[model samples]
Target: MPNNGCVAVNDSTFELHLKKPFQPLLGLLSMPYAYVVPHEAIEYFGNDFRKNPVGTGPFILKYWREGEGLVMRRNSNYFEFDHKGVRLPYLEAISISFIIDKQSEFLAFLLGNIDFISGVHSSSKDELITRAGALNPKYRESIKMITGPYLNTEYLGFLIDTSLQHVSNSPIGNPYVRKAIAYGFDRDRMMLYLRSNLGYPAHSGLIPKGMPGFTDSLKGYSYNPDLAKFMLAQAGYPNGKGLDPISLSTTEDYVDICEFLQHQLSEIGIPISIEVIPGAAYREMMSSSKLLFFRGSWVADYADAENYLALLYSGNFSPSGPNYTHFSNDKFDRLYRKSLLQSDDSLRYSYYLKMDSLALDYSPIIPMYYDKVVRFVGSDVEGMNPNPMNLLMLKRVKKIKNDTYSR
Candidate 1:
C-alpha cells in the first residue's frame, strides 16, 4: 500500500493521502511546543501579525517596523546551553536598523552605533580599508581583518542558435570558431582595463587554479589574433569578411566587459555590436536562443569538478538545466558520466581534467576570471569567519566587549 506517492504514518498504517512520509510523527508530537512550530510561521500569519517568529535559534524576533528597524530578544527556552548549563545569547537584546546608503553605514560603524558590518561595496572597499588602517594605528589590536578566495567565477558565453538574424551564423556553431573567439579576446587586458587587476586572468582550465583537476598543463585560449584569424579562415569566415554583424548581449553589470570584448574582437576584424539588456530580458533571450552572444558566470554549488563541466558542457540548458552554451559532445558526456560513477577521488579528478581539457580545446564557454570574496567587519565583532561560499553562519558569530547587542 505504501507506494512512492503514499506517506506512511506508522509501520502498519500507510497514510496514502500524504505525499511524503513523516519519519518521526509520534516522536515530534511528544516534543516541546517550541520544537513543533515551523520557522516560516510569519508568512502564514498574514498582515495581522507584526512579529510572528517560531525559530529555535538563540534570539527570538520581538518587533519589526518595515524599513525602519527590527528588534530581537534572547530566547530563554533555546535548546543550546552554555558550558554553565545556562541559555546562550549572553547579550540582552539585538537591534537592526536599515541604512540604505553605504556612507551612512560606514559612519554608523565608525561611531559604534552598529555592532558589525559584513560586506563592503566594491567601490567603498578602498576607502573603508584606509579608514580602518588609520583607526588601527591609534586603537591597536582592536579590529581583526580576514580575506580569502571565493568559490565563484565570471565568464562570457556565445549564443549557439543559428536561426537568429544579426547573430553570428559563421563558425560560431563550429568548435574551432568558438575556440578562436576565446583566443581572440585578451583576458589579461580585460582584467587590467575593466576589473583593475581585481581578477586573475583565466588561464587554467574551467575548474580554477586551486580546485582539484585544474591544470596549468591544459592551457586555455591564449591571446593570439593571428591564430584566431587563421582559425576563423579555416572555419570559412576569412578575416570575418562575409560574416554577419555579431551582437553581444549581457546584463548592465557586464556591459563594460562586453564593450571591452567588442573592442578586442574588432582588432581581429570581427565586427561586434554590444547590446545592453536587463538581467531578466537577457536571461529570457538566452533561454529562447534569441541572443547571438551572451555573458554569464557560475559559482560552484559544490566542490566537485562536475559542478562546472556538467552544467555548461553537457547538453543541459537554463530554464530546464544549467547548460547555457547548448554544447553537446559525446566524448565529454561519456567522461562526465564515468566521473560521477567513480568513487575514487583521484580517478574522478582525472576524468574531470580530461573533460576540462576537451572544453578548453572546444571552447563552449570562455573562462574569464576567478572571483574573490571581499568583506569588511567592524571592530566590535568577534568570531566572524568568512566562508568561501560567502554564506554567513551567524551561530558561530559573537560580539566583543563594549557590545550592547548580540545576534
Candidate 2:
C-alpha cells in the first residue's frame, strides 16, 4: 500500500503502510469511517444502499421508512462472544423513532415509547433535571440518568493569523485580548445556570477531562475579571475604550451559551456581539476560515489526544485542515512531531502536556467547558452505560420487558 491506501493480505487481514511512525495508529484505524462495504451489497441494493447497509458490525439493517423510523436486528452471523460464552448483541432489535421536537422526544421517553434520550436539551431539562444537575426525585423511581465524562471540549476559536488584514485590524488578533476573553467570564457560573451544571469548567488544557493526555498538570484560565481588565489594557485597549465589538459566530442551537458569554464579557469591558447562523452554513463558514471568532467543539474520532491538538497544528490551517485559528508555533510543531515518534505512553503524554501548555499560553481559543454525556434512560433499560466517546454500542444493552413498554 502507498499514499493513504491499504492492502488486503487476506480475507481476514488488511494493513496500511505509514510514511512515519505514529503512536495512535491503532486508535486511528479503529474509527468506523474505514469500514468495508461489500461490492455485492452495493450492486444488489444500488440506490438503496443507505437503507440496506451491509457491514461486519454486530447489527444488521432490518428496515427503514424514510423519516418515520428505522430498525436494526442482531446479526446472526456475527462471530463475537461474551465473557459468559453467549453470542454478542443481546438485544434482539433496536427500534429508533424520528421525533423532531425535543420536548416530544422527552415525552416519548417518559411514556416508555422510547428507551432513552441523549444530552440535556433546553425544552425538558428543567422539568426532569434539577438546578443542582441531579435528576428530580419526583421521577427517580421510573427514570435513570446516566452521566459520564464525554470526550468533547466546547470552545471559541479566534483567527490568530495576524498576517491577514482583518485579523490585524481586530483586537481579537491580539494574544492579550484573547487571554482577556478567556479570563473574563465565570465558566462555573455559566455551567451552573445555562448548562444546568451538566459539564466541568474547562480549567485545564484543551485535551478535555476524560482523554489520556488531560491532566490538572497544565494550568488554564478561570474566572478573574481583574486579570481580564489587566490583559485588555495590555492589549492597548484600556477598559475596552477603543476596542471594537468582537462578534462570536455560532449556530442557533448554542445561541443561549453565546448570549451568556456576551453578557458576561460586556461587564468586563469587552464588548461581545453574538452572530447566529444556521448549523450547516456555520460549519461551512468555520471550515473555510470565513469567520474570525466562532463557537466550536471537538469530539474525538479516536481515543487519542492528537485529535484535539491537531486543531492548532500549523500544517492543518483552515480550508484544507482543522486549524481554524491558523496558529503556528515552532516549539509546538517540534513537540508534536516528537510525540508522533514516541511509542511510550508516558513520554508521549509529557509531550502532550507541553504542547497543550504552549497552546493555552497563546490563548488562541477560549475553552468554555468539557462536555459530559448525560443520558436519560427508562428504568427498564439495562447495560445502558455510556463511555467517554459516547459511541452507541448496543450489543450488551437489554430492555427489561415492562407492562408499560410501548416500542
Candidate 3:
C-alpha cells in the first residue's frame, strides 16, 4: 500500500503484501470502479474504449454504433454460478440505446420497445405514476416500479476562497449571511412542486439517507424567512439596503431551482442574480474555484460516509480534489483524519457525524434535497435490485416471457 500497488504486488499471480491492516471494504469498492483491458488492444483503441468497452464480465461487447446504440451478448466464459450451480446471466443479450430525449425514452418504454427506464423526468412523472407516488392503475399490471433512496445530495455551495469572493466586503463572506440564505428557501416546496415529489427534502446534513452515518434527527436549515431576515440584519445587511447583489451560478438543469432560490432570498432583501452556464463550463469554473456561489451535488463514490465528508476536508481543496467550496474547520479536519484510522464502524461513524455537523454549522453549503433511485421495469423482469447506488447487477437479473409486457 505504501508503494501504491507497485512493489506491493511482486508476483505475476497477483499476490499483494500489505504494509498495514487490510480494510476489506476498501478493496471491495474496486468492483464498482474496476474494468479489465487487454494490454495488446490498448494500442488499437487507445482511449476510444469508453464508447466501445471490452470486458470479461457477464456480457461481451458485440457492437457499438456511436450516438445511436450498443449491443452486448452473454459471455460463454463467465465464471459465476447461481445458488443451484447454474451458469449466471440469464439474459440472452442486452441492448442499450443512447436516446438523449427523456420523452422519447419514456415512449419507448410505454410501447414495450425498451425493457426498463431509470429516473423518470418531472414532465412525465405524473403520467407514469399517481399523485400519491404509485404506478398509475392503467400500467400497474404491465409494469413494475421500484423506488429507493439514492446516495446523492443536491446543494448550493458557497465558495470560501478569498480570491473568488465577489466583493471585498460582500455580505455572503459572513457566516450569518450564508445561514440566512440556507434557511430562506423552502426545500419541501421545491421537492413537491419543482421536483414532482421525486426526492426527499434534505432536512438533515449532507450524508444522504440510506448511508450508514446519516442521522435523521439532525435537523438542518428550515424555511423561515423571518429568521433569515434577522440573520441578514445581524450580518449588517438589514433589508438588503446597501448589500451587493449575489450571483448564483448553475447549469441549465438546475436553473429553475436557482430561480426559485432567487425569489425566496429576494423576500429577505438578498437580491440573487442567476448565472446559467453550460454544464461543462459550470464544472470547469467550479473545479477552478472561479465561481463565487454555485449549485453542485455529491454522489457517493463508494458506500462510505468518508466519500461525502471528504469534500469538506481542508487538504482536499479545489483543483486538487472535490473540495470546491474550500471549506476548512479545525475540528472537522482533525476528526476526519482520525476517522480514517478507526477500525470500528461505530467509532468511525461518530467522527463522521461530528465532521458533518460542523460543516452544516459553518453553512458552507445548503443541503436542498436527497435524490431517489427510481426504476421502471417490465413485469417480465425479475431479480432487479433497486440499490441506493443505482447499480445494475445484470448477472443476477433474469428476463422471462410475460404476455402483459414483453420487450
The list of candidate 1 runs beyond 4 A from truth reads 1-63, 71-95, 118-126, 129-145, 161-168, 208-218, 236-244, 301-305, 313-315, 398-407
> How well does each candidate superpose onto the true structure, as a TM-score?
0.72, 0.90, 0.85
Model 2, residue 102: distance off in Å is 3.3
Of the candidates numbered 1 and 3, which has the greater TM-score value?
3
User: For this target, which candidate reaches the highest TM-score against the unseen true structure?
Assistant: 2
Q: List the lowest-lDDT window of 10 residues for candidate 3.
A: 6-15
**Candidate 1 residues 102-178, lDDT tens each?**
88887776676775666655555555554322222433344455555566667777655444453344456776677
Better model by TM-score, 2 or 3? 2
When summed lDDT is taken over every stretch of 10 residues in candidate 2, the lowest stretch is: 1-10
Stretches > 4 Å off in candidate 2: 1-4, 37-40, 43-47, 288-290, 401-407
Task: Provide the overall lDDT of each model, using Cα atoms, as 2-decimal numbers.
Answer: 0.68, 0.88, 0.83
Over the full model, what C-alpha lDDT does candidate 1 score relative to the true structure?
A: 0.68
- Ranked candidates (TM-score, high to low): 2, 3, 1
lDDT by residue (tens digit), candidate 3, 183-256: 89999888876876778899989999988889998888889999999998899888887887898999898888
Model 1's TM-score against the true structure: 0.72
